[model samples]
Target chain A: MHPLDEALQMQQQDPGLYTAATHPGYANAVGPFGGITAAQLLQAALLHPQRLGEPISQTVHFAAPVNEGEFVINAQPVRTNRSTQHWLIQASQDGHMVAMATAVFAKRRDTWSGVDATFPHNLPDPQSVAPMQWQKRPEFTNRYDLRYFDGVIPHELSGQERPHGQSSLWVRDEPPRPLDFAALASICDVFFPRIMIRRQRWVMIGTITLTSYFHADSALLTQVGSDYVLGVARAQVYRDGYFDQSAEVWSAKGDLLATTHQMVYFKD
Target chain B: MHPLDEALQMQQQDPGLYTAATHPGYANAVGPFGGITAAQLLQAALLHPQRLGEPISQTVHFAAPVNEGEFVINAQPVRTNRSTQHWLIQASQDGHMVAMATAVFAKRRDTWSGVDATFPHNLPDPQSVAPMQWQKRPEFTNRYDLRYFDGVIPHELSGQERPHGQSSLWVRDEPPRPLDFAALASICDVFFPRIMIRRQRWVMIGTITLTSYFHADSALLTQVGSDYVLGVARAQVYRDGYFDQSAEVWSAKGDLLATTHQMVYFKD
Candidate 1:
């Protein structure tokens, strides 16, 4: 199994009880990459027998740092309607909750389709851009291949302050695995916090809450395969020690896959 | 008390348990207005004795239609950290769960602050713009004082079809009450579904999931008083009968107060 697959793997102890071991390959500064945990939480729901459909929207709240070890996850399908299902999932270690999430799933049907946001233009192809190399960064950073089209990389700060927080990049799995919902969820967090890019310095930052809306289905994701996807992220406001970031994930063929928003806690 | 206040008012039945009555003043096509329900869910969390600081992010899932009558809300502070708190709130009518929500609160400290989005300019003052009058629309329409700056209002659609889903308007409580978290949460849903505006047709539409990030504190809200706030909303994509809408609420002085996103279910 791929390291990511192994990292997100869970053993079903009971119908609603799951046990997952933390993997070092996806480790962040404090714990496992939040994106992996998010995917695990969604995985629990997807594996449930009563799961209704594909995920339409999901919100994950990081209550406490997830320490390395075996953790328990409990997912409950709170409500299942004719066309939709609501789920509440939580992960805990030693009886203390570390993360919680809420997800909504629905069986989609064909209808009028349109895209309002314009596809970004004039960007170097993924093949032309060289992948960033950072040996001492978080272990999680090593799991993805990131090629920046704009914004400064963390260690190479120019000391030139920026007036805005924005970054555009091409990203994909390091091992080039086929794209899926779990991988897409993890990619949503691939962009380093926008503050790091704008201030030209690395600071202590953590995502407090994240919400993502899926715009594509399995067929689209399968078509994306192992190719790099364009990612664009920017911060709308930074105030009272918390900043909100909004991001978009687009396919190489110009398909909008997902859009995510989160509020992050930062310290100077 | 204004009708809005009455519509959102909840009676404490016990610790973590509250009862709220549905009022016709906020009635939708099939149930109470979703905005009112969102406000009530936040109210339950705010009233919790174990609650922490201000709300930073909230996501509410409308699993089932909230029937008109009395409903019970159970709010639980699932995890409480030193600086942040996570909450799970659910509403049930009889024995069926109608809605579920998750919220994150934190004790904020002063930090570097900046607004990336510009305050919308070149719009007429709220007073100069006439309120939209729709006698046959959902009863909830009367609860807000909306002055359109662009886009065709339902029932008065122009023959011209819009290629994009976008709406800009000024909104205030019908009775002009000072803003608070609950009131602000409700105002985020004031914009009609973007699909209706883009297609220039009133189709069956409902919000499946809504998430909002609060950018303002109570002190700022108080300073703004009862003045109208500008609201700009647009759809990113409409596919498979579902479209995602994103919006921003800005004060008269151009401060971004909150940003909201929602996925809606639409029929042709």
Candidate 2:
């Protein structure tokens, strides 16, 4: 069975209040390093909003240490205001709040507007580049349906290690569903645990903290025009085995859709 | 004349496209030590929306290079959708984008629906703590209407060292305005810069980056409470006197109004 299927099976009782996935990497045998990847848990949370799968804004707090193990994720809608909706997701290990998140999603609308700056008219369209076909083991793959528009990985990640910056790839909903702004709010932190250290690979030490702010249209499944600016991502500081970075995920052309910031534990 | 007047005076005739701000200190600043101080400029940005009197969600980028000088700020309202309004503020020096911000704001409403569980509780009442009185300063004195609710400065900027965790203050719109959401978005980067110092006394290093998100709500200025929860904030990582940190600012009633993550320069 697929790992996601197994995880779903464990949750067959369907305690829709939370996810019943047993992520392997976060098992106790691995110590703190074993904690379920934030990405895995975040994916589960984002999937919860598949019904209204529009992207929103999310802020996460690392309340305590998380060790790899069988974990449960609890998520539910908090407040549905006039223009925005808020959801709270908590990931627990052995009944402790390891990581917690708050997501704010905006409602759908037909129109949006912003400044029309000169987009790097020079940069090639993400489509013009060769498709990035990176396959993840079933354990990690179930979490994301990632598509790479910028075909080339940054040189720093290219085995050629240097204090260089990073790049952007087009990402979207997996299993294809319409999601709202709230969903986007949660995934913005998906890349931070892996920022910098491109040439060298490091299993996510863990997400010390992940947070994001959502802007633009809430409908991610549709509403294309690149009203958002080109995605500009970079790692500002990575030292002493810890890194802090931020990324601007632009709309297709060059409107600013969302901005994300993260601090990751680089256990090198 | 107000320091703000000193700052915004000349009103350079340039159409005003945002540009990046540069500073002196770094892993490699020719001068033994120099850096950017972002909180002040950030506070300045908060006043803009209030100036225009618009309510908006806030998304700020700490741009690649740290901003070092007195730059200009231009807030362009992107789309005033029926129910929502969006704007992008660009901070620039000569003609480069120093930092850009995109924010969303909603029309104020008196009531909304929320899960009872989401109702903020378990927070101290604002009346419980004595309002902190700040000694006047020639520069920042009246510029900001700062009311220290939870943690009091007790003393002037004598540069004394104390605790290490996050600090909280009650920040509201000055000059008697309706403390709009955009105003809070501006100051979100305010208190976070000083969390790094083992001692309170430190000089201006530049801020590498700042990313902020809007939270559920804090009581409007009228319902203002006491006891601010500095919430969870930390110097996630610091190297060569440069560090980045994230903070969640909560109101006395436990309402998480706004959260901020900033990369500021700190030195011994």
Most accurate candidate by TM-score: 1
Q: For each candidate, C-alpha RMSD in Å?
A: 1.4, 21.4
lDDT of 2 by residue, B191-263 (tens): 5245423344334455534555554433443354322333444443333333445566555555455556654
Question: Taking the tens digit of each residue's C-alpha lDDT, what string does model 2 give over A1-268?
Answer: 4333343333412432554555452233233321233444445555664324333445555545555446667765544444434455667778755555555444444321222112344665544554344322333323445444442343234455434446556554334333334334434644423343343333445444565655455333247422223454555434333344566666664545566776444444
Candidate whose lDDT is highest: 1
What DockQ, between 0 and 1, does each candidate earn?
A: 0.85, 0.02
Worst 10 residues of 1 chain A by lDDT: A152-161
Candidate 1, B59: how far from true, in Å? Answer: 0.5
lDDT of 1 at A78: 92
lDDT of 2 at A38: 41
User: What TM-score does chain B of candidate 1 reach?
Assistant: 0.97
Give the per-residue Cα lDDT of candidate 1 at B264.
92
Report how far off residue A248 is in candidate 1 (Å).
0.8
Error of 1 at A257 (Å): 0.6
> Among these predicted structures, which one has the highest DockQ?
1
- Per-residue error (Å), model 2, residue A70: 5.5
Compute the lDDT of residue B113 as modeled in candidate 2: 17
